[model samples]
Target: MLPGVVGTIQATEAVKLLLGIGEPLIGRLLTYDALGMRFREVRLRRDPKCPLCGTAPTITDLAVHRNGAGGACDVSPDGHPEGVAAAVAPKAGG
Candidate 1:
């Protein structure tokens, strides 16, 4: 039920954006409170340092997806498998 509601909102927003018919949710956050049956909107500010949306974005290319070794799916930047820690602490007085 919750997912359906969110998906409908997202689809509606996409249509509005493509047609430029009504105001979109750009630069804003829309939150749904199912328990309270309420919806709230909050203005959002763009961060200049954001990796994907920043002034000088580093993720502008698709190189990350082409690697194939986890690529975009790899959560760790250190090349460790997902859910595995990159480093482990030394044993006390090892």
Candidate 2:
């Protein structure tokens, strides 16, 4: 039953995103417990004073937070194409 409900909600959100309609669960955390058969939603809100996406954001450059440790993507230890699939894709697209 829990899986059924979760799948239904996931499908519903997918359709909503495709059509750009309905209020999606963007600002809420939904949880379900199978044994209890309970569903709960916790409202989420952004901090107004935070630098990122705030009224007066100061952090404009994202390079400061970029993880340059892995400067370049390379093949996995095993040298398998499928294993390095993630390394092939860029972190962020253009």
Candidate 3:
């Protein structure tokens, strides 16, 4: 949800709510397996250019590419070799 929006609950609030009911999960790692069962926490990284929560300028849209072999790349807003379709495609009938 957009920050500062009315009636929008923040992540901190959500965590607090869970903790209030004896389900405190702060600092506790959580993970899911291929069967969708809770497992353990794994290492993760924060993208400096993530549109949702990054230091770079916000991006309105994102383009995704894959090689059908589990390999993928996340393109940024700026035009780059990895950004094949950063901008929206023109309407075909327009």
- The C-alpha RMSD of each candidate to the native structure, in angstroms, is 11.9, 13.4, 14.2
Candidate 1: list runs displaced more than 4 Å.
Answer: 65-94
lDDT of 3 by residue, 14-86 (tens): 7678678544344443433435543454333454566555677454445332345333344434623332133
Best by TM-score: 1
**Alpha-carbon TM-score of each model against the true structure:** 0.61, 0.47, 0.29
Residue 45 Cα positional deviation in candidate 2, in Å, after optimal superposition: 1.9
For residues 15-89, write the lDDT of model 2, one tens digit per residue. 998999999988775766678878877665664544556677655666435657354333233532232234333
N/CA/C clash count, model 3 = 0
Superposed model 3: Cα runs more than 4 Å off: 1-29, 34-38, 60-94
Comparing candidate 1 with candidate 2, which one achieves the higher TM-score? 1
| Better-scoring candidate (lDDT), 1 or 2 | 1
TM-score of 2: 0.47
Candidate with more favorable, higher lDDT: 2 or 3: 2
Instruction: Supply candidate 1's per-residue lDDT for 2.
Output: 80
lDDT of 2 at 79: 33
- Candidate 1 residue pairs that clash: none
